[model samples]
Target: MAYLQQAPAWFLWLASLGALYVSAFLPRLLVYLTHCLRRPEDLRLRYGTWAVVTGPTSGIGRSVALELARRGLNLVLVDLDAANLHEVSGTIMSRHAVQTMAVVFDLSLVSTRKGDEALRRLRDAVKKLDVGILVNNAGIAKPGAVFLHEADVEAWVRMIRVNLWAVTEVTAAVLPGMLRRGRGAIVNMGSASSEGINSFPLHTMYSATKRYVAQFSRSLYVEYKSKGIDVQCQAPFFVSTTMASGFAAAWRSSALVPTADTYARAAVGWIGKGSPLCVPNLRHRLLGWYLAAVPGGVQDWFCLRENLRHRKMLRSARSPRASACRPHGHGIPSIE
Candidate 1:
């Protein structure tokens, strides 16, 4: 203290500026460290006996479901593919020694009262279980760049139905039970595209829907934090999974693009803590900070260029010449 008081004024001013700069990221760094150091919560004790995950057949959802099971929580796994859903549930049951229920229904089927029926079925299935954690992880993205006016009408609408409507309806269905019980956590899967980029031109609808998820989750958190519910919107840059397999080779896991399992483990630790909007990966958090410092026009140009490059690669892969060289009957399933 005596040494600090004797320090030159110029040095003190510089030290204060450095401290302020570092303070911006200190909280997030502490959160990451705390997650790593602490033992994870017993889901059964912290939330409830059963946790529900949508899109649990593959990718991030499957990883999170397995993690929850490992934490001793029974699962309600929802997916459109009955076979895949059963397969995932069976694996979790066998390895984790936890019970799992597979609910097979298409979230994008919003015609002829099908969407209503699907939600009713989902609500009924979940209501039977003491669901404590809900992960709204189901979403769809258009594969390439096409102007909104040029895109297929049916496919675009289907993206909206699955990405936005499913999240809202499923949350509505499960939230009442949580309110009555007075304890639960909700994790809404989002994307870094919602944060870093100025505009995701190729993935316009998907980006817009994710923005909605972030905003909705924040508002929900404000409304429910005192009521024993934790809501988080997690926006990750990338994960090496089937949904991201096309770009997997190009973008490997780091602190930025963590493997699905790694990300799931980290994400579960923040279930009932931190700000409502979370970018779980350290690299993504740093990147978001950097992007925010960039001028808006520069961010816009970068996003446009990056998405256009992705579009070119997708088009080339789907070209007739390229398709002829691939296996005769195999195709990447459209489910994810």
Candidate 2:
């Protein structure tokens, strides 16, 4: 204290600036640290007994469905591939003490006239169940990154349809039931390519769609939090999955890329937390903190370089399916 009183004015100002910087991120740091110690109310009890998870056959959706089931929520698994959906349902039923229903629906068709029957089927399926949780985890991207003008127009349309339209429609179908029950948790999947950086260069359309998800989740959160609905947008850096397999091996290393199951384990903990947005994986949150601190120009520059590198890697890849992004209908089936 005496030393501080004697300290020069300049030193004190510098110290104050440093303290402010540290304080800016301290709350986030604490939340990330106490996550393990904090025990949220049982989701099944707080929300309801049944949960609906879209794109539940693979990747983050599959893992999240399993995690929710472990916590005693019955699963309604939605997807386009009937075989895969049924297989996932059986896997969940056998591995965990939870009932499972497989709903085959094409997410990419949500915005078209043909989507009406599919949405009606999904609505009908969940109407009788106590649908307490909704995970809109299904999404897609164009096959590799390309300039907007260089790509076929349909590529952009498909991404918007599945990523944005599908999420919107599925939530609409599930929300009425939650409103009637007066409680639920809605988790919309997001991508770091959209939120963590300033601009995602080559994957423009894909990132733009995800940006819509983030806004949609935030708006719903404010609108429904008082009514007992918790809306959260959870974004992550690349996870090691078939969707990202086209990236360079070094960038996709296990240390940098979490597996889908690893991410899902962390995700379930934040279902009904106070925050409207989250990067559930601890590793991801740490990286996100650093990214947030960096200047936007620097981030955009590096993001462009990394995306371009991935594009070249995908083109040169020997595999027929070398794209980091999936082809149409290649997206994991989920609610539409």
Per residue, candidate 1 scores C-alpha lDDT tens digits across 116-225 of 78778888988777899999998877543655776788888888888887888889899999998999999999887776667777677778888989898999999998
- Worst lDDT run of 10 residues, candidate 1, spans 245-254
Question: What is the TM-score (0 to 1) of candidate 2?
Answer: 0.87
Query: Which regions of candidate 2 deviate over 4 angstroms?
Result: 1-19, 246-253, 318-336
lDDT of 2 by residue, 166-279 (tens): 999999999999999899999999988788978888778888999999999999999999999999999888786777764434346677688888999888987877578888
- Give lDDT: candidate 1, residue 313: 69
Question: How does each model score on lDDT?
Answer: 0.80, 0.84
The numbered model that scores best in lDDT is 2
Give candidate 1 misplaced runs (Cα > 4 Å).
1-20, 110-112, 246-255, 324-336
How many clashing residue pairs are found in candidate 1? Answer: 0
- TM-score versus the correct structure, for each prediction: 0.87, 0.87
- Candidate 2, 28: how far from true, in Å? 2.0
Worst 10 residues of 2 by lDDT: 327-336
